[model samples]
Target: MWDSLVLGTKPYKRYYEASLLTRYIPANSTVVTSNTDSEDLRSAVFKTADGEYTILLEAKAGTDKEVTFDFGGEPPVGKTFYKHVYQADVQLEGNAVIPSASGSFSTGAGSSFTDSDIDAEHNVIVYTTLPPQTQVEVTPLEPVVTAGQAQQLAASVIDNTGGVTWSVIGSGNGAVTAEGLYTAPAVDEEKLVAVKASSVQDPDSYGIALIRVQPAPAAGRADIPQFSLEYGKYAFTEALTITTATEGAEIRYTTDGSAPTLSSTLYTGPIFLTTGTKKITAAAFKGGLEPSANVFRLYKIGNVSAGPDGYDFLAYDGAEELSFTGTASIAYGADGLFFYKTLTGPVSTAGLFEDPNPASDDKRYYISTLIQDEEPAVTIYNAGFEMPVTSAYLTGPITNGWAFDYRSGVQKNGSAFAAAVAPQGTQTAFMISRSGITGELIQDINFREGEYELSFRMASRPSYGDILPFQVYFDDQLLGTYQPNPSGSFALVTTEGFTASAGYHTLRFSGIETPQESTVFIDDVRIRPKGSPPLPENPQPNPLPEEPELGPPLEELSNEGFEAPVLAAHRKGPFTESWYFNGYAGVHPNGSAFQPPPAPEGNQTAFLQSVSGGQGLIRQHLEFKEGTYNLTFQAAKRSTSGGRDHSFKVFVDDTQIGSFTTASTAFQPFVTESFTVSAGAHTIRFVGAAATQEATSFIDDVNLNRLDASE
Candidate 1:
């Protein structure tokens, strides 16, 4: 063996060996020995006498060829091949097949090969790119390539792989083929290839055909096949086998027009489509591959399961397209109602429900129900009062009346008229008792319905004893008139129908003395078919359906702090009577307007409810810069004798929040009052009283509102 056998090679790879095979052996001797095949140079294996075990020969080639590999953990888009390639070299003690010589070559076949001779041998990696113009003819080459060959994809054995290596063997974001094989690297529309055949010593180097991988033309798929479904396929047995230019690919069938995802099983066979002209569509694809769509129309009978006896799971859009398409199935065990539904129209009528044989558990049928709702009750509004019921008989004396005589009907118990239920006290008044100090008598009566009759010998002694003609009033309205017999005997003013209807009503009596003698006196009073008169005006009115409103004004609570802030004081009380908020309210507990200091954070402005209510001129003054204020008291009645009514005069310095209205004698609940104060605590009071007639009145619910000054 001689070093001259090999030449022009440096930067050799390091190695360890059992014994030197090239130990100066004779050039003529057969210096070859069976080696582990992976050993890089298999130095000239020749042993000398005495077994020194040394031989010399050709120098080894450069380091092994560097194969750049790449791949994506995705399926192959193009018809890339994979084949398992095991290293073919003489195995060294450590199995390290350091290449004897290697250098990249950009010229001459795009490969680095050793000079070839009878005994020349070499290997090296070089890239060969399939240009954009290279035509690809995907021939199922190797007629017998797939026969029980530990079958691996052609992409595996990319020995001396020249094109893109997305990754080296067994590495990086890459995917193995279904056949358990990996391809070279993934290149963008670039084609790298592996060779099935190459010369032995041609560096054992391989070359790939330069054909651009055009993302493997997406296999054109046959439309979702419309089946001539026959009895052989009683249960829709056809695979709906969508034939595509691709094999081993999957079809995502959407028989219900629903989107098919990875979770949807592959369309291996026909699916029993649901009722209504079935529309079956399929999207075919390989992993990370573009999708091809196929749509097919077919009729599937609702055979396996009994659908609505009259319809084929009714069609919603229209009854014209009711049929079972093979994508969905009306299988025997399926549960649920399949009819088209709508809110407004009759999807299923009452009669359509097959009696569900409620008597037995096994019996099943279709049934539906109807829902009806009641409308809201109507609210009523009437300015006039209301009397719910009517009935009664006569009962009572004819006292409480005024004879309209200055001598007897004076504001002090002077009687000229009579009344049934008028204000009986205070400055305001009602029925008078007597007239002229003589005997001017009056009669009180009730109406059959909302009306009343009055029969009295009324006489007016206007001046000392001067009698003047007078009239009677029914509930403040003047009725008929009558004259007086000085003796005041029975002067009938009503024989019958005189009292219109039955209800609580007022009757006034009056007449002229006609220069009369003794005071007039009347008698024989009667009232019947009575009805409790409606109280004055009813408050709440019926509101329009769409125009509801909560009109009460709201006030800020507990407002405090300083600088300046807006403040609205609120006051609540019986809407019926007027209130007097005398400054006395300010001094006493019932009218307390307490002010508190500001909170620390109040850098902003602060204000108070400078407003108030009082008698004649009273109110919650804006105690900006405080000072003492005076006050008075007044709970006096303002009604006529035998009657009662009250009104309050509230003034805020001069503004009034206290309004006044007379409280009628008709049945009514006592009311409450309230008000809002500024950003501080405050005390408030309620004055109570009544006239010389009935009992006194009282005010309650004296509340005050305050707010935080800052916010």
Candidate 2:
């Protein structure tokens, strides 16, 4: 490699140092020709790993000679090159001697440099064209300054002298002193001023600080208008009222979906809304003060009717196609409304509400009549693969509404090589087939007996031309088998109308194994009535409504009290009957080994112990109706040696909805946020961890119940 040697001592005659070569020429550097024609000089060029070139020149023991050295390529114009000269005439201090003369020169035209005065007799000259590396940072990057106020700023330069020159950018905005003191202009209007600090050593390097200048507060603005009724769909005509908290403010409103101004219609009383959708924009204003910010609300007015066939339909228009009699509650969805009511006969007009806007051919309404405690259609949970927010890929047993088998999980689009962007959301479900094993994702859906169609988006990894084979199945019947085009983009695939009975049916997607491993991405899976409009293309789901009052516990989960396969006092074991346990988690009876409070429901409780810096998790799958429900449980921290506070997380499928931490030795009841599940199977998981090993959390008496109308 690029290394040199020299020998001698005392007067350092003909002395050569190995450290000199290793210091300038790095290991593995290639030695190249310097292209110099001079009998009095010996030269070598080296190319470092970072593409930097270093030149070494030695003048023989003779008269001084001028030499011209050529670099391979032309150096950047005005680029500085450092030069270090070690002369035999200079006195050596110790084993490590400093260079006799050190300076730098900039390239003016070409990459060649001619040294006019090169001392002879054991002279070493090292030349490198590496640019000076410097970083300038300004303190108080963003500061709020009052009009005419001064703020002190500082500049810090790394790898160079700390001296800097401060200057302001905005004209007539502000000024900065040489000492980095910034003063805002004496103006009433708010403005932003940029203060720059340039490095004294490197003029090209600098940092800027933004200063916000605003006038002092004078008076508060009027309060914005508020509506008594919340926005969204309504089944009947409604009266809306606008109000403001500002004492002497006047409310102005607009009904044509335009911004409300001072000259808009004045609000005197409640406004009545009949049919069709309306957008109300309102604002408040008071004399001698600024007008309040405008508030906007959108309301879709529709009508509900009951047909003679015992089915109810909610229509967007006033057209009365069916007779009305019974009272029904309304629920809102992404594209339409659901009229839920009890009926005596089988549903024959369930499809009537499918198309609410006949003129536009928009299917906006749906009828979910309760026939023998069963509804025709239910919502789908996590249908867009948007749960368990992840940045790259996540795989485990807690996928919320979906379960994975083998090499199947959710992944963020564009996170890995060849992964394409999801067609609907930021994440998609991926199934891989490798080693003659097919990866699958399964979800059990509760659908009423009706004709339905299944649809989803599918794509293959980008640049991977292999045909990804996949199949969709409902229960034991295969709906369709597909081999997506290798275009690397998603395409919507829909199955023909299929009949489904009212009960829990396993819906599965399988990536078929082939000679070559393959991967298939699935997103936005949907199942709708045979002819119903496809869920609004790439629709954003509506936020869940406030949970209603819980009526009674639904016997949906097994071993809620952790009493099955009971263990003896002071004993613990993996006795989970209807639940899945991961890490150091299982059921344990109240014992003295780990002092725990009395069981909230039974003699035994589920326990999760953190060990080896790992968290413990317990999860169970349960079926739920399409409504809001409450989840209640009791948790306590185990009193034991090396135990600390326990932290717990609750998840419905892949989304973590709530979490809590417990340090109390006695059991405490905890009611989590309402979980609104579509009528289907969903996984409920609890993950617990503590700072120290052997820390355990005791959980018991977990219950979930659907809320009723009466709070």
Candidate 3:
């Protein structure tokens, strides 16, 4: 030890040495080792400048544990060269002693807050370190489970310090096992298990909980029912059943084939069924619960039935049916329906219509109902035999948009019914027949393959320049002239296209006479390649001649317009609402809602915005200006049958002024009238006036022009 400063030093009574320091040996390894009994070195200390004591020593520190030495007292404040040494006691009662520092447990990892794996057999200390004032929580929230099962659940506890014990709060198992993890009961059941843990080292380290339960997985459902039906046919239906079942099952169905809603009734009876396919489904539902999926399946019911035999095919069978009438209604029947008539003053020839010829081998014809001008109509269908038989075939006469005057048929191009005007009346029509060919250009069409005969009705007749002269073009080759010489039952005839391919081809029965029989009335025409059935008649029906058509529900007519809910019998109809709609034509339902393209000739509609004053006043709802307005409307006069002359007139006020008649021949403008409106709102109406001459007139496309207004 060395003392550098003795600030204003004053001598003490005991002469306390200024500083004393010395170093020499070891204890266990002899650091600062000194022999206390060594007499020869008793005076070996060299003198200091003022006799202050200072000694040098060696150090010996050994062992893996930390080594430390404590100074007995404070060192001199300003000492330059002083040293001290220590070691494990070499002679502490003859053994060394280890030293220790103030090492302790803490918030650091392994030293204190450590986490261990938790399992069925082992749960070591779980340490969650936190500041003294902080708190924490751990929870066991979501857990997974297997399919088709359920159980009770549990959660773990939590605390602040570290190692903790989790305890169950409710009724579930306390410990979570390796393979037997705790699960909560079903949601329908009451109690469940809850768990948590508390720390001991830091008192409030963390707290946590967990929960587990069975899952309510979605189930697989069976298929639902599917089908539709006609009223008179099947009395049975079907439904599908579900499996892996839950309770409170229900099933719903519809006869009209509409989809079932929740409010639909449940099926309870054993439904009857035929042999055709249909849809069926079953569902499961209870109060306040979501309905389970429907079990669906297709169930076949029955096949279509055939038509009856020997039924009458008359237009006015005295029954209220549209298509098949008299005796048994032919909704699905298919044969022999005829009506008897007699001789007439005038006849319809060179016009398209169906006629009964008992002169043929059979007396049956095929027919189907359709709608024309919104009125029920018919079409005779001859599925085969466009190939003419020399002696007999299956078609009637064809005309150029003009009616047959008697029983007119539905004219068509392909499957669609033909429109009235083919631009202009410039095309030809023929009366191709399968009866006897008494004249030339006619055919007997009832024989087997490889044979045909053609003839006409009357043999020879008076003729002018090029009268009744037309060539027969066979496979694009002119074969012979069409002339008749009325004769034998084993008729002689002419034909074309016998060497041509056998398929559907137009026979082109055309001739241009000098206004004398120019519209060829020649019949007996045919051609065939092979054998087939004796042939079925056309499906189009023969319209009644000037006859009344009584419809379903038996509607009657008198003179009063407001007396009944009749459509066409009234003085006026379709009112002012002439928009684009085909299903709304005339006063009848076109059977379907409006569709685009052909369904709506949106371009064709009428607006009766103008009329005469006294006959009809403008409805208060309509507004128009007063002026000398020029108005025009398009009119179509369909096939009509009643009396000799009938007028389809547009009435100005109450007086008839404008109209369309059979006289125009096709879709042509009829009459035009002018009316003066008294400045305010005025009304104009389109009316089909009833006349002494009976006829059916159909109005299709229409246009209205106002000299003063744009609309």
Candidate 4:
């Protein structure tokens, strides 16, 4: 058999073929009586090592012959015989030239097969019944375990009377006991480990389970140190204290601006700031824990100076005692020059600061006693809301020269709601109204008791309209009711001239809420003599909406009532089909925010809101024959608070045909000025505008109809 398979080629194929017979037949098997009926056939039977008989038959090259093998009653009745036939084909190439084998099954006391007219071939038929298969199944196919933890597993054996052996598949993955108990490796990193169970009866049959091992959690670090005094300029001495929140943690500090280290001075008591500026850095440390992040502060002591040109410069460092009224308090220490107020009712809070340096300057008396008289001028410190510089969205009472009431504070420009750039600096003071309660920013100044006007750059929140009107006050008297333009950009507003008493008087900008909530932004506030040249009024208005001329009309705006793009819920988009929307404009179902009024023609309406302080627009293009046309639509304000300032402009092509305000929550019809267009295509656009954030407009049933020549 070996020589026939080798066929003058490498012995690898011969060895492979021999192993197949020895694997199942066994070399010690004994031959038994086996014979074939045809003269051209030969057969022999052998008893396998497993006590079963196997028959081998050989066919000679000749005419087609049907051969039968006689088992002589040795094989059991109803026994299934497995037949394998091997034949050679010259047409095959490479490894394919080797004789190919085919298999089939037959059952009975005797087996018969037909051989076609071809080259001689051998057939091996086995009558032995196969033993039941041995299968091993590992329980918990996948498990998650923590590092250094142990998990117990189980293996079940089926169809065989044998047990299983347990083993690990990867090095350093983990270890497993013979009883299937797995212990995960003690690691700091996560890994996957495979545990396997192999059947002893059938070693080739095995089961595997994967385990995910997670690393242990880490320890926490020490807390950073806190300073007793806020970092800023001061005119007097200060006692500074440094402490940490971590229990039993020691604080190390450096006063020379260098980072604190373990070798730095241990903080035990308060450090005295007698004069000059000092930069302090501190960090906290505890046993067996990482050092905390460093905290730094700069304190300038005795740094107050006289202003040039007979002007007295004054600064509030939050340490001075000031008269505070209502619900207000000054925050000192690390919070740094902040005044806080809590609104419980309709009352307001304020703080008063009198001029500390009201005396005139005199020349050196050694020469000639000469006292110079200069024009009386009072400068408001931190007038631009630039003090307490911070990147935070909102900071407080701003004790650096101003006081706040209720929802009023200093806000970083562009931090909340994508506002326009500040008129003068990176920060602006803001007052908000909620639940009919308004906010105020107050500062007491020692005016020369003359006619004065208040000037400040004011803007409405971009997302909401300027629904809340604000007033300027000289003490308890109102100067004027100022309404911010719907445009989000800041505009220099100068209040009407008002008279003030000579002593210290309060300058307050208070908000007046009209049935809803709103917010106003104030920056660069100044109280100057009435005729003082008004701050150059260079208001930066929001750029006009760009309406690109679209291609000729695509089906004449089929969804005029916004009935298409039907949404199961409210959604924002640049919808398609007949209309195109830019920015925060989309179709909304009736009864939705801003669409409270039933749509004029359908259950849905189109809504638009300002986009990042700019106008939100929706437009459609249509071809028009040279003639006069009238455009009309239904508009309504959003049904929510702060929605009163909603308005929109209608444009035919590039020309603004009309501007309309949606002051009422109910849908109202609006007609644009009749327009004449040349034959061709033109665009109709509705641009939304608001004076405050959260303002929205709803529109529906838009139509453009040609007027009859007779009219």
Clash list (residue pairs), candidate 2: 6-16, 7-16, 400-653, 400-654
List TM-score per model, in order. 0.16, 0.27, 0.22, 0.29
Cα lDDT of candidate 2 equals 0.63
- Candidate 4: residue 300 Cα off by (Å): 8.7
lDDT of 1 at 162: 28
Better of 1 and 3 by TM-score: 3
How does model 1 fare in lDDT? 0.27
lDDT tens per residue, model 1, 374-488 = 1101100100001100011111221122222233222212223322111111111112233332322232332233333332223332223333445556555666555544432
- Residue-level lDDT for 454 in candidate 3: 32
Go through the candidates in order and give the clash count of each: 149, 4, 121, 11
True-structure lDDT of candidate 4: 0.61
Residues 1-711, candidate 4, lDDT per residue (tens digit)?
222221211233344334335444547788876655576767667776566656666667645455544444435434454444444222322112222233334444453433332244443333233433355667776666777788999987765568898999979888889888899987654456888888887888787776767554336877667677755555544557788778999998766567888877677655655345567788889998888777676665552211211111112334333222112112211111111222222222233323233342211100000112212245455576754444545544435567776678776654654566776545677888888778887876656557877788888885864545788888888888887777877888888888877667878888887676788888877766778864567634334323344656864546789877654224343334478765357776643423367777866788877522556778888777788988888988776533445777889878999988888888899999999888877888888765434457888898888885733
Query: Candidate 2: misplaced stretches above 4 Å?
Result: 1-129, 218-285, 290-383, 386-517, 522-711
User: Cα deviation of 479 in candidate 4 (Å)?
Assistant: 0.7
Q: Lowest lDDT 10-mer window, candidate 4?
A: 362-371
lDDT (tens digit, per residue) of candidate 3 on 610-650: 11110111111234455655345434333312112224445
